[model samples]
Target: MPHTNPASPILQLRGAQVAYGQIQAVKGVDLDLFAGELVSLIGANGAGKTTTLNAIAGTLQLSGGSMSYGGDSIAGLPAHKRLRAGIALVPEGRGIFTRLTVEENLRMGAYTRKDKAEIEADMQRVYELLPRVKERLQQVAGTLSGGEQQMVAIGRALLSRPKLLLLDEPSMGLAPLIVEKIFEVIHTVMKQGVTVLLVEQNANLALGYSNRAYVMDGGKITISGSGQELLHDPKVREAYLGEIA
Candidate 1:
């Protein structure tokens, strides 16, 4: 486990609200993420975890409240601008370009950077982190297995050199072994000074791997506590946790 300071949060949200036309998905959710930490958001279907992450990544506009990154307001910034500001999101379903080769997909991740030397360096770094991706460099993304595709998605996100990585369900549609591998990569990313905000359906995996976790339901955050605390909560045990009688 990495040393996590109890003080200082890297990103903070205050009374954040979001909507899609007439459908309001989030209702004044508050969250805090610190540097070099892995925080998780776990809840059942329609819990609004994805909506919250989309708000932070600027993929969706916030209807009310404020979002600050590294102590600066970025509410007016667009998604690409947010990417330049050191934020990257690996959305759900491993949003990889199926038509592209694995290596080409990685290249697309660094499209924002023009420095050839740095871009190549990042490619090598990602390959080192996920050696399987190296073997499939020439393979088409759509042809790869579900787990392999997820690795490519994560590697692509890392190419952005983000300070904050917003991942929505890195463990979806894969075997337990594959899920473990994904978590290992996420741990490695945190060590590289890239904070991770994970939204996962697997409550057990999320709580076990994160320092702290939050639970969302009915368009609101209902619980926020240390990972172990939430994992041990009576209600959490019955609902999200699985050690029931």
Candidate 2:
């Protein structure tokens, strides 16, 4: 991992809260993402991990609290503004335009940017990271397998040239081998200077690859530690890791 400045976080959330009608999904969630670090949010269904990401991406508004990026307040920014500010989100479902070719989908990701040459270069870089995507670049996105679609989603997010990448359930519903490949690509993305905030159901994989992790339940963060520490903690092992502590 690259040296991250602890004093300055790339993304910061203080007492963040999100609600839907009568139910609160994320309550007073305080989180930080430092530059060049892979941070994870691990939790069960309805744990609010996805909600947190949505709030940060500006798709969902925070009922209370504040969010800042690089010391500037982003609380009122819309989703497009946030994307323009270098925050890109690969949502849970691998949202790609099914009818579009892989290349078309990738091109859409760079819509917010004006540098055509840089965008093409970034697309090539993504192809290097995911060769399978390159092989299927001219194919329709819907014709690809689930794993390939996931790659397209990630590749699209990369094309945005984001400072912080929010990945929700990148490994969900994929085979073990495909998941491994995705994780490998994620590490590569981090090494290339994009900070990642991952929300995943696979606690073992998340804890293994992340520098730090947070456990959320009941709409709030309940535990946090270094990845290794959480991997070995009795409570974490029992609850998230499927180990009978």
Top-TM-score structure, candidate number: 2
Worst 10 residues of 1 by lDDT: 1-10
RMSD of each: 1.5, 1.2
lDDT per prediction? 0.90, 0.92
**Tens-digit lDDT string for candidate 1 (60-177):** 8789999999889889688899999999999889899999999999998998998899989999999999999999999889999999999999999999899999999999999999
| Winner by lDDT | 2
TM-scores of all candidate predictions against the true structure: 0.95, 0.97
Runs of candidate 2 exceeding 4 Å displacement: 1-4
Model 2 scores what on Cα lDDT? 0.92
lDDT of 2 by residue, 115-170 (tens): 98998899889888999999999999999999999999999999999999999999
The true-versus-predicted C-alpha distance at residue 221 of model 2, in Å, is 0.7
